[model samples]
Target: MPFEHYKEVDLSSRNTLGLPSVSQYLGAFHSVSDLQHAFEFARNLSLPCFVMGGGSNILLPEYLPGLALLSSDRSIDIMGDEVTVGAGASWDNLVAETLKNGLFGLENLSSIPGTAGAAPIQNIGAYGVELARFVVSVEALDLQNGLAVTLTVDDCQFEYRDSLFKRHPERFVVTRLTLKLSTRFAPILAYQDLQRLPAQITESAEGLRRAIQSIRAKKLPDYRVFGNVGSFFKNPTLMKSVIQTLEQAQVLNSNTRSAQGKVSAAALIQAAELGDLSVGQAGISPKHHLVLENRGGATLTDVLTLAHLIQEKVERRFGVTLEIEPQQLTQLIHAPNPKG
Candidate 1:
């Protein structure tokens, strides 16, 4: 297929936030050959390419000046307990497929909204289980070399909601992901909500899947009905000394636990009584302090404004800075160092 056939596509449906935007150029690649051809087209035009998967984690501005590559291929293969999925494969689909095959490692990540290829970008995690634990390798198209390559888990540099893909956004476009899962029936019941689930001998992959879905349904707003990109900000990790100072001053909640002396950002936000704070169409979800939601027809500017306000309020109250989890498209507008 000619690359021109997929150029300048509207990206409203592609992104989860449903933000209306138009890419200067857009290309869809289903196979490795298609990806190579797309890259060639991009090179000829001298336009930077932005790779997008399910578009669950991004907030696109009203207008994008570069090419957007939408990965549409969705294929999966199972080798015993190991699963290899196409980059365009939905992450929630992988979780469901694993459970059907009696694999248990990904049950905790059920209902996450993104593609398998994007999981390692943020080391997508939930309920104490992270994608890094099961990732075997990642296949990506190296933009600089004009070839495809495979990266091991170590090469990805997995961290709390960060990885090599996120650190260097322009270097590679993920094409495929291989994950190592377990056929055994060991369920991870470590998170608070999971521990509260009723005990059952059938606590296998399927059981854990059901429990995770239930917990997410109760905690997170449905993206289909309500516009949201999951948790807006990451739970800030503070130094031990700073946590102690806040604890002594009664700024940190009593229920907050120490992560080697670091306090939870959720606890701190709730302690500061900013749980239901709102600014125009944006507000912090009263149900969960970590989530910032767009009530309706909210623009990217509104979201960023509320986020900055929340960060400033938190920092002024506790002297700890909060980092946003989702990728921001308009960081240039807020040029001041957020740490300030």
Candidate 2:
């Protein structure tokens, strides 16, 4: 049995929001054995447990109630063209490693922040490629039974920016992920920015990676210096009838229906003139309408207020609701109210 260590841990360093707080107890697990021991210890002590990966998508309040278990074991093994990575392994690192090995599918996802375990949590996607397309299986520890289980791709129940793990957070602690990648160069350049590259060039994976990185660098704020999560909101998808109503009202800037008939959320937000809206210290990113940034010393309350205001204004103007992407701290004063 692996021994578990617990202590009062500061969350400011663990979460990307950088909110100052202390978890009641915190521990790190390197292997399945370690995760099992930690789970048992939390159960014996009757404390709720929270699992964390790279901590990119969470907001912590001043005091968190339970133990936070961080996955810190970073290991990767490549067999033929299949790659197996520890949950704690950095997501970008895995992409880079795959590219170095001549694998092609992950190039479009380069530079995204977070760990491999968290990738499947949201089926992390960018520049036209998503993690779900390549994922073979995920290894997780069942917290309730203290048993390790391997989940196939279908078991993950992937959707746009969501997965079964998110819907059932308490059921499993992800330990590792396995992906199948291609050896030959095949690229997807359907995104507008990547489309600028000559068709012949984008036909190769290396060229696609360069194009994706270049586009992202120009569109997204550099996270190293700026304390901002990628996109603050998921583009609100709208039904065809809703789109027609908005169009008839002359309330839309531009509308593009997905093959599945959903309207684009970004287009709706831009049409609402919320691209440059600001509240207190938080504001919609001037560069991208869907992003909200905390301009120094901004509190979670400030961000939430701005988000609520945006939602309110959009609903008032076009009758559509905007959904936030990140998980907010439950105790924050501006936390979203329950829907009736």
Q: What is the lDDT of candidate 1?
A: 0.77
- Worst window of 10 by summed lDDT in candidate 1: 331-340
Tens-digit lDDT track for model 2 on 1-340? 6445667777776766565668788888888888767766666676667777766787667777766777887898999989999989999899888899887799989988889988998889887678999989999886556678999999999988889887777676799999999998777766656767887668777777777777888887765555567877776677778877877776653434454544556667787878778776777777666667766666777778888888888889888887887765352221111110
Candidate 1: regions farther than 4 A off: 253-255, 329-340
Residues 190-274, candidate 1: write the lDDT tens digits.
6767777777723567777887888799888776766678877787777777877887888775457546554567777887789
Residue-pair clash count for candidate 1: 0
Model 2, residue 18: C-alpha shift (Å): 2.9
Judged by lDDT, which candidate is best?
A: 1
Taken over the whole model, the C-alpha lDDT of each candidate is 0.77, 0.76
Deviation in Å, model 1, residue 31 alpha carbon: 2.8
